[model samples]
Target: MNTKVSRVYPRSLTFGDTTVELATMTAADAPALAEFVKTLPVHDRLFVRRDVSHPKVLDAWIGALAQGHVTSLVARDGATMVGCTAIVVDPLSWSSHVGELRVLVAPAWRGRGLGRALIQENFALALGLHLSKLTVQMTVDQRAAIAVFEELGFRAEAVLRDHVKDHDGQAHDLALLSHDVAEVQSRLRMFGVDDALQH
Candidate 1:
């Protein structure tokens, strides 16, 4: 589980008036990331895959990033964290061609297209890792997230009825969306992002 620190990370992308710096997650960022997650609204926190408010869970995520089990990227506006995204590739040989994407954006940053930018970054990383497909699971009511993925060629592949329960014990259906890497590449080419793919 030796992790290689990526030198090509910490790149910058601009969204309207904001300039976001994206970087690979590392052990040193665990505390900061945890703090950032704490600022999320309670409803948003309920959907996060890990209990980021808990120190142990946050530590575990840091360890996973350090071990290369997850490829994570964080977006920062100046010194403040605004968003984070990751792709987890299965170690099992049978599922090696597929990866799962996760994203969390600060409430204030939601409508500014940062989420879409993060997804684009994930796609590039997935391509570089040679993954053939990517999947994302979200509650069916997340229309904004669904729309963003759909715009990028991801389609709903499955829906699990009442798959998740919120803090109030209310169940919610989960929708799983998937994208074929080849199709994503084609879409990017259509958008004149072929230059990005070449890197």
Candidate 2:
């Protein structure tokens, strides 16, 4: 219930020039994490279903985060949560081998290659859990997010035209993309990220 509980992550994960120490979500990080969710773009925010907190969703989400089924990783620049990502491992038998990924970067961290690192880490985590696939989406306004997925070897699997109606009743298309973890690992090797990069 105290921030001290999550003040430091018990494990360390590498991310470029920095190491993202990870702590399972605790009540303390709730407020900051919740505030971060508010910063996400409308369409992006809509896709995330925070199931853990009760009256307020992020609180529930934080509780779910402590469970391996839905893991959250926050990147820190000394105490500031500069970036965050979630790997939602599906628990149903039908979706047991798949996980959905959502990543967000604080405005200041954009274009610094952190997004790729966050994704790569999530992919590795997904694979470790024996997941068969990772799914994600981007709306028309998110060109950069789209490019990141493509560069990561995710193919645009579907386009749901006018799938979502805005407040004005104008339909917006959503691009669905997916990546095979094994394939992405193979592709990264061809692109210059060898084993040493993992360290």
Candidate 3:
């Protein structure tokens, strides 16, 4: 399939026993999203700053895309909610074609290639929207997340010390990684649409 058409069209994908489907969040998904976060471990929770006490957290995330500021993707396996990815695309005087990429995979689902699939799918979605760049945060503690981002062809752009808040409310540095959209798409095509966990 040609890159544009293949990626622009959304299709259901399967990986192992997991059937991954994509959808924009609605008010109805708020409950599932809340539930999804409640089940996450502390380490995983910090990535997205989970806080039900703050209703605005869900409000801004679920509505960011429709609000024309960001794109959010929810991944599901059967009826079980697995993970969510949020892509922030904001306009800037320097460059409006780039979209910021941020993602979090459920801790239990980590190591099963779910993160890669979610990222690639999200990347394609962002590209279909005409974005040409994607950026992600890389904290010193998140070695695994860093590896995944690097493997996906993201390059380290900068390191901002004390850039994020920890679970205990401590600040830490965040490594910024970026990838050219065209390069990421080409790499995923070479890597194929599915990984071994699927077979």
Candidate 4:
């Protein structure tokens, strides 16, 4: 796989008066990432597969980054992490060409373009990595997040009833959304859009 794409790192994006820098996530970012996750509301954290606020989980994520099992990008306003994303893949699995996309943005930063930009960055990264498919799941109530993904071409794949429980032990329905990356790329190439990816 090429593994090289147009780098969005050190890129500056503005949302209203707020400006954030986008860069690849690194092991050194664990502390800031933990603080970012800790500030998320309980409802928002309920959908996360793991308790990212915990040190061990964050440590494992950092380890994944080192192992190339995960590719992440962090959007920062100075030293504060305002948003982040992860593309997780297990190369040994049968679905190795499929990546799971996880995106999180601070509550205050919601509705801005930050989240969409992070998703776009990850989409390009997925293409560069030669991933054939991408999937994302969230609680059914996250309508806004789901809409954002949908706008980017992800479609509903499945729904699991009461699949995830909150800290209070209340179960919530989960919705899985997926994008056919290979198909999209093929269509884009047919339409001459793939020329941009050649560089």
**What is the TM-score of each predicted model, taking all chains together?**
0.87, 0.74, 0.79, 0.93
lDDT by candidate, in order shown: 0.80, 0.67, 0.68, 0.86
Ranking by TM-score: 4, 1, 3, 2
Among these predicted structures, which one has the highest lDDT? 4
Better of 2 and 3 by TM-score: 3
**What's the CA error at residue 38 for candidate 2, in Å?**
3.6
Candidate 1 off by > 4 Å = 1-7, 186-195
Residues 1-199 of candidate 3 have per-residue lDDT tens digits of 1112124223466788766776654566778777787776665445443443356887777776566666667777766668777777656446667777767666777788888988877766665666778888756688878889899788889988886786588887777888898665566568885232121
Model 2 residue runs over 4 Å out of place are 1-24, 43-55, 165-170, 184-199
* Alpha carbon lDDT at 127, candidate 2: 51
Q: Pick the candidate with the highest TM-score.
A: 4
Candidate 4 lDDT, 78-160, residue by residue in tens: 99999999988888889889999999999888887888888887777888889999999999999988999999999999999
Q: Candidate 1: lDDT over CA atoms?
A: 0.80
Cα shift from native, residue 19, model 1 (Å):
1.6
TM-score of 1: 0.87
Candidate 2 lDDT over residue span 1-199, tens digit each = 1111212345565656777655445567776776665555555553444422234676556666666567667776767676787777657558766778888877766787788878877765665555668988767567888898899788889887776665467667878889888676667689877453333
lDDT of candidate model 2 versus the reference: 0.67
Whole-model alpha-carbon lDDT for candidate 3: 0.68
Q: Output the lDDT of residue 153, model 3.
A: 80
Candidate 1, 23-139: lDDT as tens digits: 987788877798788888765654456656778878877878866768899999998889998787657568777878888998888888889989988878877776779999888
**How far is 173's C-alpha from truth in model 4 (Å)?**
1.2
